[model samples]
Target: MKLIKWLRNILNYRKFNCRRRALFSLKCCLVCKKPTKRGCNCLNGSIDKGTASLGPCLAIIAVLLILIVSFQYIIQIHPHLVRETSLSTAINVTGVFLWLFVSVLFNHQSCVWISPGYAPKCTDGYSSKYQNVPDEYFKYDPELKNDETVRYCKQCQTEKPWRAHHCRVCNRCILRMDHHCPWIWNCVGFRNQRYFYMFLFYLWVGTFFFIYFGYNRLFELYKVSSCILTFLPTIFCKLEENKIVVMNDNSLSWFNGRRYNDENQWFMFCYYACCGVNAVMLTFLMWNSFLLVNNQTTLESFQNLNAEMRKTRKNKKLRHFKYLYDLGSAQLNIQQVFGSKYYLALLPICYAPIGNGLLFPLRDQVHQIVFADTTNEPPNTKHLKVVTV
Candidate 1:
């Protein structure tokens, strides 16, 4: 009886151990926990360290190849374009445009590679750190019954700072996030937003200049046989008043030999394709310009539209909507992107914006009402209350 009991006890212990090991293995994978492309850990909070989709990379490479081919054909058509005064102007314009475009493009790419920063983790007193922030940024949750003024990201298991949201693709919380742009293959957030704007500005200007300068080469190729005059078969055709005649070797060519195809048709096709890309770039450039002027992120712009739609639908009337952060001046808005120095805005180097990414500057008399605290004395001094160490 004792030998049978000992064997049964040993078997039960082994079964328990096996179950524990199986559960541990399940928890190890990111998919088991979150079931998304984003991995367990993200770099610099927002930088996606995981494998990227090949689609965006291939698309970018294709555009570059087309541009190179266009340049090659342009040179082939106009060998003396570098020396000719009119053509030289195109060369100079394209050269400078390409330089600036490449400079900002890589700079923006670096921004994407860099982390947008992570929200503070909730464990080991990290969650308590954000509680000291100003009332305007974080509201006191009365439901907690502890008067703790803080918010948390459930998925990240971390303390979420104001304006911080978790990006599922990257699997981390981004601060002051703009949007996830697959074109750049990264998230556009506070740190990289400046570089992004410069990239767009240069790309728009450069591509437009390219289209204008390269127009002659493409147009000349397409206009090779635009004016046509057909003669009747075995009939003597002539005009009375405006009698003019042009001779062609069509009859002789049929008897002899003929080259049916020419480079003109292919050049025309390439021109149309380039024009199509330029058109898309032009449209996006305008949209980005509108966003910069309005001091809004791509994500915020979409959110604002949705909110306005919902509001209008609910009220059954169209009403003028006001944005909270809009300082009501274009210069101020532009300053947020370009920084205070005028020259820095044009350069590709990194320049920090006026305020920290966390606490953004606001228009006068707006925050006083929005963050009115009953506990704090002296109602007018509420602005001073915003200074949270």
Candidate 2:
């Protein structure tokens, strides 16, 4: 390849500029034949598969369709939802559309641009020092707990903070990472976690808002569509001839499908789909809240859970579970993620975390136990790790 490039350069005999390159190689040949390639590079393959079980393409499609179809369907069925003047219906529909717009903007930004806190370049020195520690040191040894600082990551070629962990999809260590949320196409980390949770909150609210009033209309729509007692199947009769289908430019009526479009069935489908997605997002939001309130991250929870299980296997004794990061109270734990002010948790406003992402407020007793045995010098204490007990 180098020789080909060199010979081509010499034969061209022109200055190393864009215009010369475009004219030379083709200008020499009487016949200009070009073979253009399309689609993804064969060697590079696709990163979407590795990012999550549900690929990026599918996730993007799902997000867009829900945003559009749900709102359109909601407008069509607004009368059934809000029993008031047409002006009130317009306002309600406008609210749903505006909420969805915000969700899409932040969700797209979260997935494509946010950085998940990569380990810094200077951490290589810490990594070098960490390499000298014995392998058994990584194990949960109760006696050597306080000395287990400076975890070395082979992929990032640097040292990781106490709660930091490697994400194969992001291909780096993230500081205070919650999870690799594929839907957003980004890892939820220190910076964009606020956006991610906000997106979830809005999505839940928008969908549930539609469901709250539209539920009765949806049930009636479903009831009219099916009739086992009817002598013939739906396909056997001319749907138009049945005259049961109705459409109105002004009012809500039963089983009204448009001339070519089955409006009733389509509306039902959209409502049910939105309801299901809202349910999933609601569950995810609650789980995220639980993690935030307990002062635990998803990755940390996994490690702690596995460690507990392993200990149980050896001892085979029944024991109650405990949280190492728990601040001994739910309110303090919630403040750790949201802010010192309690109300910040309820709003989506941007607030800088109290800790600068490096140091954190550990439980008072645990903090003392972890650092008690160490001396107060950089050379002596920099390698000390936080012991989670």
Candidate 3:
């Protein structure tokens, strides 16, 4: 009976529905199994599953659609536009569009492929460095009770340092976690945070490029369709019936039997798509820019907001709370995620933060500041240690 029960436990399967079909799974990474406890690369692969889930498959489809539409526009429509416009203007717009497209693709790949820095394993809730250290070593740390500087994650079975958070989707503690992005199908955290930001920036700009160039074409299509419906109702009816009707008027000669040409219809679809995508990207880009400038993650922003609300309730006059990791300089704050070289910060290459995600440099007053007790009266500084961790 004991042997049978152990075998049943080992063979246990969970049922989940995918595309209206319920499937049972065991240790397959493509299903519900936890990521292997090995290298970061394997962890990323297991989490993303390449094209296993709907989000990743959708993302792949979107990218391919964009590529196809853009190629069609460039080949079939851009030449006429170039002839109408000056050579310099066409060259410049094409260059900018190509750059934006390339940047978006590279950054998107980086965000999807990179691991969001996992918290290293620890022995008995303490890192290797602190495993044998005396209890008095952590006495000066003010973050937690009993002067413990590290937090243990039961899910990962590891010690998490400052800013680390456990992701339910990834099922592991990600160091400096921002949030899990469904579009990328990965966590935006310390390692891939910069890539994620660049991806948003490039995608936003690329959509804007499409919106700008396609605006005139979209307007022409709309005007001709409206004119056909208004002045030539018979022709419009023919178009609705899928019959080709050629307009005899010199001004309306551009209109064929179809309400709009196939290329024009595609351009219109892409234009509206860009408009919607741009709106979403704008909101995300602006929010992320604010977080980057202030040295906070999405999680930290919510945490700080809650802290402020609690403080406001305690003291009606206190409205603003200082974040511990701001570093006080916007340039320095931006440098924390991207590399120190300011010139290369805008580039969409591998310029991730150089530090192990386990530790972070604290603000000068982190030791002196207390979230619960924020009276104007300065706390005693003699015994406080300003440790960079």
> Best by lDDT, which number?
3
Say which prediction, candidate 1 or candidate 2, comes out ahead on lDDT: 2
What lDDT tens digits, residue by residue, belong to model 1 across residues 32-97? 655323322322222232223332464366456446644545543344345444767756755675
TM-score of each candidate structure, all chains considered together: 0.61, 0.63, 0.68
Worst 10 residues of 1 by lDDT: 233-242
In terms of TM-score, which candidate is stronger, 1 or 2?
Answer: 2
- Poorest lDDT segment (10 consecutive residues) of candidate 2: 36-45
Error of 1 at 56 (Å): 6.4
RMSD of 2: 13.2
lDDT per residue as tens, model 3, 1-389: 42353334334312222222211222333543574344333444344432234455555776786697677558644664687698788788788777787788888878877898876555455567644433332222223323234455777775566688888666678889999877776788989999888888878888887877865555444544333466533224222212335657666656553434666566666766787889899999999999999888998787566754335322232224446567667877887788578567466667657555654555555534432344533333322233222
> Could you tell which candidate, 2 or 3, scores higher by lDDT?
3
C-alpha lDDT score of every prediction, in listed order:
0.52, 0.55, 0.63
TM-score of predicted structure 2:
0.63
Candidate with better TM-score, 2 vs 3: 3
Q: Which scores higher on lDDT, 1 or 3? A: 3
lDDT of 3: 0.63
What's the candidate order when arranged by decreasing lDDT?
Answer: 3, 2, 1
